[model samples]
Target: MDRIPILRMGNFLLVTIQVDLYDRLAQNLESDLVQMVSKTGARGVLIDISALSIVDSFMGRIIGNIGSVSKIMDAETVVVGMQPAVAITLIELGLELKGVHTALNVERGMQLLKEKILIEESEPDEE
Candidate 1:
């Protein structure tokens, strides 16, 4: 299994993992990813899935799990670049993601993350 690599871009962290199938890769890093989110102190995350060909129940679960962990770490997780076929396959497989953020590409994903950060930063303090 190839290791997931993490890169920093501004306030967001980009996690790139090469995988033929999203499920397998997610299974491999479920725990490690959770730890990574905690350790990095990242405000947001962009998961580049341009390499994945398909998504299954396993992948959906892992995505959901990562989102849960990211929430606890106060980081927003955005999955990016899922192919149309893969998206249809995931739907047909009855694989449902539990409210995790998603984007069509890395740039959009990063934009969304940055916007979230900006919104948070701009919020007025509640006295």
Candidate 2:
């Protein structure tokens, strides 16, 4: 599997990759994503899963892992572009992503991230 593509835009990190439903794509992806979150302290992440045709246990676990790490780093995770079939499969499989967030599309995810950043920035300082 190919390494996931990553883009850093302002305070958001965008990831694009083809998930094969099997293999180490998820693990490889997490490595790159973790680096981005750690290095930039990015306020949010947009994971584009449009290319994936299915979601399996491995993939679901990886998503959960990414969410945990991101939370630890103070970054929010938003999965985007997940297909309907994939969504159903994940739900049926009982893949409970404890702390991960999802969006119907990348644009919406980006908007959510922007709002989060804006709110965080605008909050008054607490002594």
Candidate 3:
């Protein structure tokens, strides 16, 4: 079985998509990632999709679902390195990827994750 690699770096989980994702693979990634967050109690998730030149609606929703689910688990998700075509396709699909933050690359995504964690930490919890 082929699987996407999810690397843990301190309080973050970094996923670099290096291959095309089939339906089963994408499903596995979603399940595995959430499980990883539960196991590691990660503060953030950074997903790199630079290798992918094409993204269909399924992939877009999977990405969006990852962000939403991770947020519910108290982990922030940042999707980085989206190609222009992928971005355009996502928009055309009418998918509003809520709760997902994006960056140009992994470096900026990590920085944004740090900032998100710090900001959320410093803010008072609502009643």
* Residue-wise C-alpha lDDT for candidate 1, range 1-127, written one tens digit per residue: 6667677776677877575545555666766767766777788878887887766677778878888888888989899988899889888888767657999998899889888888888887643
Clashing pairs in 3: none
- Give the alpha carbon lDDT tens digit for every residue of 1-127 in model 3: 8899899999999999988889999999999999999999999999999999888879888999999999999999999999988888878888766779999999999999999999998788753
User: What does each candidate score in C-alpha RMSD?
Assistant: 2.2, 2.0, 1.8
The sequence of per-residue lDDT tens digits that candidate 2 reaches over residues 1-127 is: 5677889998888887675744566777888899889888888888888998877787888888988899888888888898998888888999866788888898899988787767877787643
Among residues 3 or more apart in sequence or in different chains, the pairs in candidate 1 whose N, CA or C atoms overlap within 3 Å are none
Looking at model 1, how many pairs of residues clash? 0
Clashes of each: 0, 0, 0
Q: Supply the global lDDT for candidate 3.
A: 0.93
**Winner of 1 and 2 under TM-score:** 2
From the highest TM-score down, the ranking of the candidates is 3, 2, 1
> Which model scores highest in lDDT?
3
lDDT of each: 0.78, 0.83, 0.93
Superior candidate under lDDT, 2 versus 3: 3
Displacement of the residue 46 alpha carbon in candidate 2, Å: 0.6
TM-score, structure 3 vs. true: 0.93
Runs in model 1 with CA error above 4 Å?
Answer: 21-25
